[model samples]
Each structure stands twice: as structure tokens, then as C-alpha cells.
Target: MSSISDHPLRYKLANELHARPFPSMKAPCSAAYVAIKQPEDAVSRDRAQDLAHLTALLDRHGAPHPQPGATHYYGQIGKYWLKWEQHTEFVTYTAFSDGVVARPFDPAEFDVFPSDWLENAPGQRMTSILLNIVPRPAEDVAVTGSLDEWFVSESLAASEVLDGAAIMAGDFRIDLNGHLRFAVFAGAQTGARRIGRIVQRLCEIETYKTMSMLGFARVRALQPGLNELDTKLTGLMGTMSDERASAEETLHDLLSISAELETLSARSSFRFGATGAYEALVDQRIAALREERFQGRQQFGEFMMRRYAPAMRTVHSAEARLEAMSSRSIRASNLLRTRVDVERSAQNQTLLESMDKRSDLQLRLQRTVEGLSVVAISYYAVSLVGYLLYPLTQATGMSKGMLTALATVPVVLLVWWLVRRLRKSVE
Candidate 1:
């Protein structure tokens, strides 16, 4: 048999898994990460513009460009290893340098992305972080003391992750420099790949957490409009139950409310769905860290549960409320439509009965007219017969009165018969 031909996408599909490889990094290094998205319709934004932006940055460092339609790019840019990945609603850029700066989480590190270039960016930044990685210090107390000086003691969450391959700490707060900070200390024997994974997870957690919060904002903004619509819908539904209200009018109002609700749902559906996905990813990444408490410090999972879970719950509640309102409006509309249909059916029945009564009256009037018509025709026929039989009376010796009387009976009978025959034919 001839060799089997491979599917066109076979190689591409197989390579997808390894397409965005984790950035391998040793300890004593730092990474700058940023994610950007359009303020509106980010998912459907022009990919070419995004590619152009990336190309512009690469050109600044005289670096090679990515493939025409590539969704990811990894290359050396100046003194840093730059990784760029395009996502459905956003894009992320990470730059990893070989060594840490003298000052921990230095603001200057983010300057690698030039301010002028950022000014002309296709979208606003969703989140940006300065991450520092160092070898695990022998003195745990000294590291803890440093963390206390660097981050707010109350908000800081420090923990050992990846089964103690590394210890990570961050306050999850924006510093004066407008960048979040993260510190990771890898075990001396930890593999570079493990360190890379830890850094990747940190970036993901922050990015996804921020993205998920967007849903919260959307829900909050929708509340006032939702309340207004709810009130209007409730009033309209109340009117439906009122005997005096016109069913047609009630149905019209109900349909209007339903349309508004549908519009709202349409506007927010994508954001809500994306929020759920991002929230799930945030949880998954946190779980993947396999975090453990460090020196009694609150672990990442604990902090998220305490602070983040409530917002997610609020978003869920809002979504549920919206869905319930929509369903209720639809139900009310259906009921109103039924009411209108029944009323119309009853009106039609009454109209048909009235039409039947009119038809009966018209039939009675027609029969009376036909009776009069026969009598009149018979009288005229008798008069004409008397005139024509005046000469015949003299020859047959029959009197005029007798001949006239004789013709009257037959003529009356004949007119009656003709009228009956015509009526039968019409019927």
C-alpha cells in the first residue's frame, strides 16, 4: 500500500502544545510583565495593529519580526529575553533579564518598554508587574525582615510553593511606581524549568485576577439600569393582572421591557463569560502553586479566599439576578399575549353572533317584500284581463264582473307560484 498522506494541520496541531514554551530562567534574575487590551471590543480588535505594535518594538532593538500571523513571539531584545503572546481579548509581554537590579523591584526595570512607544500603544495596560527571583537565602528570618520593609505587613502573602522548590511573597498592592511587585526565592537545587514555571504562574495569577475583577465592575455599573428596568417590568406585570387594563397595551409594554432586557444581556454576555473563565484560571493557577505557609504568613490561597471570593460571588449573584429578571419578563409577556388572544377570540364570537342576527332580520324583511310584490302583480293582471275580456263577455254572454273575478283567482295564484319559484331558485 502507498504511504498514507498526513493531514494538513497535523504538524501544526502537534506543535501547538509547545508553541508558547515557558521561559527558562535561573535564580538571581528579574522579569517585567505587562498585559494590554482595548477598552472596548477587545476580542474583535484588529490583529494587524497589534502585530504592527509588536513589530515596532522589535525594530527599536533591531530584533527579528515574528511570522505574519503568529500569535506568539520569543526573541532577544537588547539585554532582555522578550516573550509576547496574543490572547482572545488581550496580549501579554514579558521581558526576562539575566540578573536582578541592585534595588529590589526597581521601577526603572519597566523602562525597557519606552514611554513614547507605550503612549502610542493600541490599548491600555491591564496589569504590569516587576518580578525578582533570587537563590533561597539560608537565613529565612533575614528574608522575612526584608519583605516587611518592602511590602505592607498587613497585606503581604508569603508562602512556599511548588512543594517548597521556591518561596514567593507579594502584597498584591500597587506601589508608588504604579507596578505590582513579586519576589521568588528558588531552592539552590531547583531546576531552571521549575523556576520558569513558578514565574509564569505568578504572572498568570495576577493577570487573571485583574481580568476577573472586570466582571465585578461591569455588574456594578449595570445595577442602576437593572433596578430601573425591574421597576418598569414589575409595574407592567401588575397592569396585566388588572381587569381594566387593555390586554393589547399590557402586551406592548411587556414586549418593550423584554427587548430592553435582551439588549442588556447582549451587551454584557461576553464580559460575564470571560470573567468566569478568567476566574477559574486564577483558581487553577493558585492551586497549581501547591502553596504552604511560610513563617505563619498568610498563603496566597488564604488571601484570595478572604478577599477575592466575595467579589466573584457578587458577580455570580448579579448574573443570576439578570437571568431571573429576563425569564420573568418573558413569562409575563407570554401571559399577556394569551390574554390578548382570548379577548380577541371573544370579540370575534360576539361579532359573528351580531352578524347572524342581522342576516335573520334581512331574510324576514325580504320575505315580506316578496309577499307585497305578488299581491300588486296579481291586481294589475286582473285589471288587464277585464279590459281584454270585455268583448268576449258579449259573445259568450258572461258578465264583466264574473270574467274579472275568474281571472283574478288564477292570476293571483300564478303570481304567488312565480314568486315562490324565484325564491326557491335564489335559495
Candidate 2:
């Protein structure tokens, strides 16, 4: 064999694809499905708590424990088959049992999950569903009658799916028992796996639909605040063109608005992204059903398009508006900052010119002062020389006045030369 080593995650990654296998379920059965999620910060929640919660349920049924750190589990729990799956932000529990109860979509069937166990769940229920799977009757008229009786006539969405392998119906409404209901009728020759897939798709549709609506709720709550911010930003932008307005102050206000918008975006980004993903999953599952109209009732896809599509569009609109506002604010802020800098530059240039003029005047005045100093120093030196030459004149019969005049010219010249030398040395 070659000596090349395998990547550490190679085996683990390959096994993950088959981790959650589809349940093989037969007709004439019932399933109770529940999805739970923590109210906040669910994605980063401690996995140990979730494991402990699963272990508690398993212990109640005397079921064998799943492997350590398992993300999904399928095992028999008493008379029912329990499937538990841990997701990024939620966990789902589905219990399947053979045969439906006496009452159609009876709430009592949900008791497969003990009341105390549900009460002690790590998180609140995001959604709970009661699914009834039964063999299709010989006639379509009988199925119509059952659909009418089981679900509301106005909202009932019934469809023949998988090329008549099954017919499914649901009103997508919560009943008095606080559970969404779905009824599936499998064809006589339909395989168990096909029936199982249909059931799973129904469950997924309900779960994902509910999850996507959360984004709608968040957007609805954000609308008023968004409006207020929009108005404030508009007013602030108007001030940009006002020459009297302080650019620095306007920039500060713009930054504050930008910060608020970013905060809102940060808060809502996860929900919006998750909603898009969940909506896509819902659409995929419905399409996989290959639904066609049954008894002139709306198909699942049609119902979602009519009712669910509008809310998703609203969420998209809000997200778009937020981004646009943020961009506009940033552009305005940059423009204001540039304007402020330009104005400061101009002021600095004018101030520098004024300083240069003052320096020129000071230099001229210093030159005049230096000339007077040289003349004064020469006068003092000539006087002192005259007094010393008075004595010489007496001894040599020479005039004192002539000596003083001669000394004066030389002294002034020497003083001027000395001052020039000192100035050059300093320079």
C-alpha cells in the first residue's frame, strides 16, 4: 500500500451522509412529532444538556443509550419507534407506532411522549404535530368525505402525490389539542419505504414552515423602529446640503444612525438566513411529494405560494431596505468628512500666509534696529579714542579733532563688519 496518510476527518465525514436514515414505516400507523429549541442562543447551547435530556427519555422507556456525542438516534421505545435528531438550532423527536387510534387524528396518541418528559424538555416546543397514516380506501369519494370531516373545508389542502402512491391532506391549522394535524393514505401496492418518505416530508413541511415564519415575526416587530430610523436619516441627509449646518456634528449623527442600522442587521441576520434555508427545504420537500390536485382541493405547493410566499417577501423587503439605508448613510458620512477636511485645509493655508507676512515685517524691522546699533557703537568708540588722542596731540603737536574724525570712520566700518560676521555665524 502507498504510504500516504488519510485525513483525520475522512471516515467521520463519509459516515455523516448515512447518519440519519429514513424510517421504514408501514401504513395504518400514527406518528407524533415535536421540535424544540431554546428561546435564545440555541446554536451555541451546551450539547451535554441536550444529551442529558435525551438520556432521560431513553431511561424512561428502558431503551439502550445512543453512542456518546451522537447527533441522531433511532431506537425502539416501548411500543413505539423513536427517532431523535439534533439540529443546529433545534432538536426533533418523532415517535411512530403501528395502527391509528379510534378517533381520527386523536390527540391521545401523542401520549407516547410522557407529559412529564415533555415538561422537563431542555427547550420550549417550536412545533408539535400529529400525523395519521392509513391505507387508502377503494373510492376517491370516501377519501373526500374523510378529509371534509377531519379538517376544515376552507383551508383543507389535499393532494395525490408520488403518482398516486399516496394521498395527503392537512389544513395547516392547530386544533384544540394544540397540535397541527396531517392525514396520509397510502396506495395498496405502495412500499413501506415510500410511505415512510411521504410521512417524513409532511413532518418536514410543517416544521420548516413554522421555522420560516419566525423571520416574518421578527420583521414585523422591526417595522416601527425602521420607520423611525428612516425618517431620522432622511432629515439628517437634508441637512447635508445646508451650508449653515456643522459638518462635524452632522457626521456624528450619521455615524450614530449607521451604528444603529448595523446593530439591527447583526441582530436579524441569522434569523433571515435561517428562514431562507428553511423555506427552501420546505419547497424541496413539497416538490418531492410530486403533488397533484385531489377532489378540486388546492395542492400543498399552491397553498404555500398563496399564504406563505407573502410573508417571506416581506422579510426580504425589510432586509433590502436596511442594507440600502446603511449604504446611503455611509456615503453621506464620507462626503461630509471630506467636506470638513477641505474646509480645514483652506483655513490652514490662509493662516500660514498671514504668518509669512508677519515674519517679513519682523525681518525688516530687525535690519533697521541692527543699523542703529552699529552707528551707536561707533559713536561710543570714537568718543573714547578722542579722549586718548587728546594726550597724544599734546605730546606730538597733532590735532585731536582730526584723530577723532579718522577714528570715527574706521570704528563704524569695523562695527558693521563684526555684526555681519556674527549674523553669518548664527545662521
Candidate 3:
């Protein structure tokens, strides 16, 4: 029997699907999460730096290092379980512990990561969070009171998700310690895996939300330039109809605009695309929670709709506007190029006509000069013949006047025929 060949990446690709397994944990746990991203060109930043940073943290705990070039890792670090993941534009470190500290959502809880290790990170912190997982209170009043004390009521989103398996609340705001806060109240009957899924979704939502906002920030920065370009493009288009404007000049301006737009597009393409992908993840993670309103408070979906989604929409609008402007500039450039070509063609045609007229005048002048030359040559020939024939006329007793007159006609005829033959040969 012949054996079937397998693709080289078949197993590797399949395993990659499950590489980042959700962390399984029970209630009464706390997590410190931080996402680090380079301030500039994060997507293309050195991935080795991310790994080295992770190694530094692991070395501090005397834990074994991850395999070379590993994009993700999960292992015990002292009392905490550390989960590390390297994403396209950022790296995430999450440390989970079995129990909370004395204070709820305290800044010290995030001290699980050594200050020196964090200070030596390869990139800036895009986001950092303090997350707490606790058992749900027996009464709704107690839950509301705790949420009121812990979060800002106006921006807070509290939701009972997974059919009341858990209630999650967050104000979506950074606290005095420069960290976002989220709390989860899982039912006693909630399985560890379900609780893990809930926690995973929360972290994902926050991370993606922050990432997506980067696109909004880009749009805000691009607004003034976009407006200026729009105005310039409009003016240049109007110049196309102005007879006084040179087509070449208009085309030059148009090309400049097109090039600028292309540069903007090139710079923004990855960011906008990544932002879109991150936004979708945020939406999917929130939706996967199967949220229901908690005690008539806002749900995660509502909060996003009110606060998060508009920024995403603005990003979309900016992308659309940029594309429109680029398309407009391209069309305008093409039209201007055609107009310039037509103008040049017309100028060349006029030049060709002028050259033809000059050529015709030169030919006429040359023919006139040729005619005068033949006449002048005949006069000399006749004079030379008369001198030679004067002796012959005396010897033959012919009249001198008659001799000269007869010879003149023959000599002039001969000279005219010679000149005609030479002109024909030259022609």
C-alpha cells in the first residue's frame, strides 16, 4: 500500500488553534493584567524583546524559561499563575492568584509583577487592569451597594451573564492608581471552566477596546490634514476649468495631492485594519458573555453602544473619507494628465504646420535661384562662342551679325538643357 503524504504545517497549524487555552479558576481569585505595546510601529517591533522581557520576569521567580521563539507561555511563578501571550502589536502578561488581598481592587494586588521587571519592559503599557473574581452576594441590594461603592454609577456596566452564572461590573475608567478595574461575582455552582471563560472574555474585551481606540486617536490627528487636503483638491479641480491655468501646473499639483494621500493611506492601512479586527473581537467577546441586564443597570453591550461604538464608527468614517479623497485625487490627476497631453498635442500640431509652410517657401525660393543661375550661365556661354565663331564668319564670308544671332539660339538651348538635366539628377 502507498502512504499518503501530509502537509508540513498540518499538525502545527491544527495545534495553533488551541495554543492559548483559557485559564481555569474558581471564585475568590484576583488577576493582574497588563498589555504592553511599542509607542511607534508596534506591529513591526522586535518580537525577541518581548520574549526577553518575559524571560526576565520568569528568571526573577526562578521558573524555567519558555522554548525559544515561543509566542505564548503559561507557568507558575511563586504563588501566582502567569499567562503570557505575544500578539501582533502588543504583549500581554496576566498573573492570577487564588485569593484576594485585604482591600478590594487595591493597587498593591498588581504588585505581583516586580516593579523592576515592569520598568525594564520593552514597550509602554497600553493598558493595565486589576480584576477580582468573587462569589455572588445572596441579595441584589448588597450587589448594588458594592457596585456603587466600587464603581462610578454613570459609566458603570453591571451585567448578569451566562444565565445568571455570574455578574460582572466595571466602570470602564482608570482609577487614581492608573489601572482599570473589573469585578466578577460567580455563582457557587459555576464551574471553574465557565468562570475561566468569563474572566477571559472580560480581559479580551478591555484589551480590544483599548486597541480599537488607537484608530480613533489616529483619526483625530488626521482630521486637520484631511480637511486641508480636501480644500486643496477642490481648488485644484476648479482650476481645471480655468482657462488661464496651465494644464501642466494643474497636473503637478494634482500629483502632489495624490502622493500625500498615498503616504497617509500607507501609514494608516495597518492601523485601521488592526483596529477593525480588534473591534470585532471586543464585540464578539462581549456578545459571547450572553449578557442580561443586572438589577436594571447597564449591560456591557449597552455601554459599548453608548461609549465605545461611536469611536469605532468615527474610525470607519475617517477611513471612508480618506478612500474617497484618494479616489478623487486619482481621477483628477488622470483627467489633468489627459488635458496636458491634449494641450501638448495641439502645440505640436501647430508647430508641424508652421514647419511645412516654411519648407514650401524655401522650395519656391530655391527654384527661383535655380532659374536665375541657368540664365546667367547661358549668357556667358553665348559670349564665349561668339568670340570663337567671329573668325569662322570672316573665313566663310557670312555676316557677323547673322553668325552671332544663329549661335546665340543654339548656345542658349544647350545651356538650358544641361541645367535641366543637372537639376533633374539632383532632384
TM-score of 1: 0.94
Evaluated with TM-score, which candidate comes out highest? 1
- Candidate 1: clashing pairs of residues: none
Model 1: per-residue lDDT, tens digit, 1-427?
8999999999999999999999999989999999998778555688888899999999999999999999999999999999999998889999999875799888889988999988888999999999999999999987887798889989999999988899999999999988999999999989998999999999999999999999999999999999999999989988887999888888888888899999999999988999999999999999999999899999999999999999999899989999999999999999888888899999999999999999999999989998999999889988998899899987989999989988889889998999899889989
Quantify all predictions' global Cα lDDT against the true fold: 0.92, 0.91, 0.92
Model 2: per-residue lDDT, tens digit, 1-427?
Answer: 6799899999999999999988888989999999988777555677777888999999988999999999999999999999999988788999999876687778888998889988988888989999988999999989988988899988889999999999999999999999999999999999998988898889889989999999999999999989999999999999989999998899999999999999999999999999999999999999999998897889999999999999999999999999999898899889989999998999999999999999889988988998998988888888987887788887877698878887888888998999989988986
TM-score of 3: 0.92
Model 3 weakest 10-residue run by lDDT: 37-46
**Which ten residues in a row are the worst by lDDT in model 2?**
39-48
RMSD of each: 2.0, 2.2, 2.4
Higher-TM-score candidate among 1 and 2? 1
| Regions of candidate 1 where Cα sits further than 4 Å from its true position | 41-43, 379-395
Q: What TM-score does each of the candidates earn? A: 0.94, 0.94, 0.92
